[model samples]
Target: MRQGGIVGPFPSARERLGNGAISQSANDWEHRYRRTVIMSDTVATALVVGGIGNFFGARDAANWHEKWGILAFCTELLVLGALAVSRSWAPAVLGQGADEFRRLGRALFTATVVLALGGIALTSRNIKLWIFVAIPAIALVTMTARYLLRLRLHRQRKAGQCLRPVLAAGSPATVRDLINRTRKFPHLGWRVDAVCTTDGLGLDEDQLDGVPVVGRLADVAGHVRRDGYRVVAVTSDPYWSPHRLQRLAWNLEGSDAEMIVAPVLMEVAGPRLHVDAVLGIPLLRVSMPTFTGGRRAIKGVVDWMGAAILLLLFAPLMVSVALLVLMDSRGGAFYRQRRVGKKGREFTILKFRTMAAGAHGARGELAGRNEGAGLLFKLRRDPRVTRVGAVLRRYSIDELPQLFNVLTGSMSLVGPRPPLPEESAAYGPDIRRRLLVKPGLTGLWQISGRSDLPWEEAVRLDLRYVEDWSLALDAVILWKTLRAVLHGQGAY
Candidate 1:
């Protein structure tokens, strides 16, 4: 079918040509960003290697070239070589996700192992300095540099710059869902400029959400070739048969556009999902979520140690907050309430008192005023909240005492949000999956809009965490928690 006939009215040649500019601009920024990362990594590696070599080899300055310079040069080359081999500088991973840092870490590890093996093979004593200190320092500096660069990229994306132009193809409902998600999380860097539904139309005849309806699903590759979309996202739909999908992939070959097929299982991701080929057919294999393992043991150790250190560090602040709470409200310095934990166990969760003495008793009277989602009860301007409590809740200072809970093994530093007894009692079988792991002091719910998210969204995030829990994911949540606490957007 003709392009114009597939869609109602194709864009004029000038407009079609302008579409390529979006792809060009995307390529330009991505290229620049990757180059910048390469340069940063090079400089960071050099600085660490040079500084260590010079400081340690200062006594034999005359023989430094023979003794240290060669090793230093070799080390830098090895590090860079490892990064290239591991695809650390790939444009696709440069500015998003944990994969960029994960690759960088793997590269550094490879370089370190090679250096250690080389040192042992050569019987070199001085190599210990590089192994013990220099490589670690380089990792720190390079990771920090990459993080700063990512922050800059995210800022640009938030401002509607430096985003991949996407052409979504699916049923209208699924395509619209994809559109909503991209707009909600702009930092993921997708901007759906056009869409192609199964029928070459949407709920609205010409457009889906705000994106133009370009053509039918069959015309997706043609539109992508013509307009140069950076990403062609294929959401799940009955129209996409295995043979048709293969044809689509074949058509997308040689084009700059990357085709991403969304799987039927949406909530399960990360290390649990793997691709395998069985009987000449490619299959998406999902491993069961782990609840008990060495990793969980490490998580427990981290929770205990991390909570102890934080408790010591925040001791003075906690005391001050307690005193203020006592002064501002008719309650004890701390308030303890029973919350359901892992395996449906009940534990007393502690926090600084943030409400009047009889706030729980007064809950029924204000039931109609609840602004919370799901089983949560929230009030943005609850009269029962003490003056000091408002500030404490805003910065999440009231929950500082939860470190003791973490220290005592009643809660984790990161996991699902602890539900109240009534809430847990009301949980359906699917929601009961949250009880498989210990409740968290702060979780995906905390970092992802807290009380501001809808009940369903809150549950979805929790389930996702339960499904895809990992040490790396926990670290990310902890790091983001500081920013979320500082912003205090959804705190009631």
Candidate 2:
């Protein structure tokens, strides 16, 4: 839901099936789902308000409708207009990034502000109820609808449908990296149909990483037009000077292809990027990372409140798990181990014991069976795991007690995973960057692949989280974590 939105509607038969495919016939063949998505959102807002009113009482619903129908209609349109003004419907944002959700949030806030100003202008005092109910309902329902639609789009992309062919124009290394990354995450909907290099140095092989070399940089415009490529990505290539790139962009005018320049700064997130024009030249500006101040304080408050609430809601489940652990093994129900936390402090991390009382004593004997990375030790079929423990670990039920860690400020609900002391000792400089933030009960590594992730990849994801941390990113991770837990993909 964070990325990808309804591009317009489904393409016509000629665009999809016939020889006159949109790729072949039109240069402006980007997904045009803004109209459909926006219209449906508006309708959804109206329906939700009406449905809420009817749910309260039919007579009341009718009475309210009669009294406020026109005003309500205007309000809905205003919200939609705010979204459009925010460029939430821009083609580039479709099906990509937290910016879409961020813009949606801005639109909702603008709606609220607009309503407040309008009520003052009219000197009305009765609009409070309408504002309180309608705005939230509209935001929730519309966002939910958009999320569901995004899920559908992801399914289609996974099945290789709705993908726009891309012609990668860059050096061989960067081009291969882009292809690999796009292939790895097909939800991005970029299919490297062909590759175009700077000077066609590797054209003798006609391919790099299995993507055919269509042409050189000079031949990009022709290949894009002839082959109907929807994307022409120019990644960090020195050969394409700024003027040369500008000319290429001009050449692509009115064509179906959209030209994108992949800057060298790939690690930065959208929220941190801005464009500044100085004397007619556009420069990409990157903001410094925010790890302190008001936002961090807000994160701390959310972690404490969220942990307390989750503990209350899951009390019954936690008690049941505790009882099961005690009955299944002749040991304490709860386990505590010293783990490193934020600022390299030690904390007693808590969990539901899933092994025998003396399981730690057997570590030396089973060292030969270790299957983990670096200083870590993991065994898929470890002998020490009790019957109840196996079940607990599978869906991560054992980690439930970490809520206390989060509540006590030793952990966060979302951050990098905490490493053991020995593991911390083995860390190189890059890996040590993870210690800058409080470790989390769940994080990118948790939702991604958990124990199945390779050591290098896990460190990379953790560092990525460290660099681009945001509340929206955390929300996305938590949502994905729920799905991962339900599916139990990589849990041991």
Highest TM-score, which number?
1
Worst 10 residues of 2 by lDDT: 1-10
Residues 1-492, candidate 2, lDDT per residue (tens digit)? 113443322242223454325474222324344555677687897896666545532343333433465556667778878988988777676665666677888888898898888777776554575578878888888877777767776776776556777889999989989989998998887888788887675535887887778678989988776656788999878888989899999999978788988878667765777889989999988888777989899999999999999999999999999999988979889999999988789899999998888999999999998998656799999899999999999999999999999999999999998988988888888788899999998999988898888888888899889889888788778867888998887788
lDDT scores for all predictions? 0.87, 0.80
Return the top candidate by lDDT: 1
Backbone steric clashes in candidate 2, count: 12
What is the per-residue lDDT of model 1 for residues 1-492, given as tens digits with 9 covering 90 to 100? Answer: 112111122232234556576567667677777888999999999999999888884345354333788778888999999999999999888877767777888899999999999988877778888888888999999988988888877877776677788899999998999999998898898888898988898888888886789899999888888788889999988999999999999999998899999986667888888899999999999999999999999999999999999999999999989888888877699999999999999999999999989899999999999999988889899999988989999999999999999999999999999999999999999999999999998999999899999999999999999999988788778877998999997998
For model 1, what is the alpha-carbon lDDT of residue 381?
A: 96
Candidate 1 segments exceeding 4 Å error:
1-19, 54-71, 123-128
Error of 2 at 258 (Å): 2.2
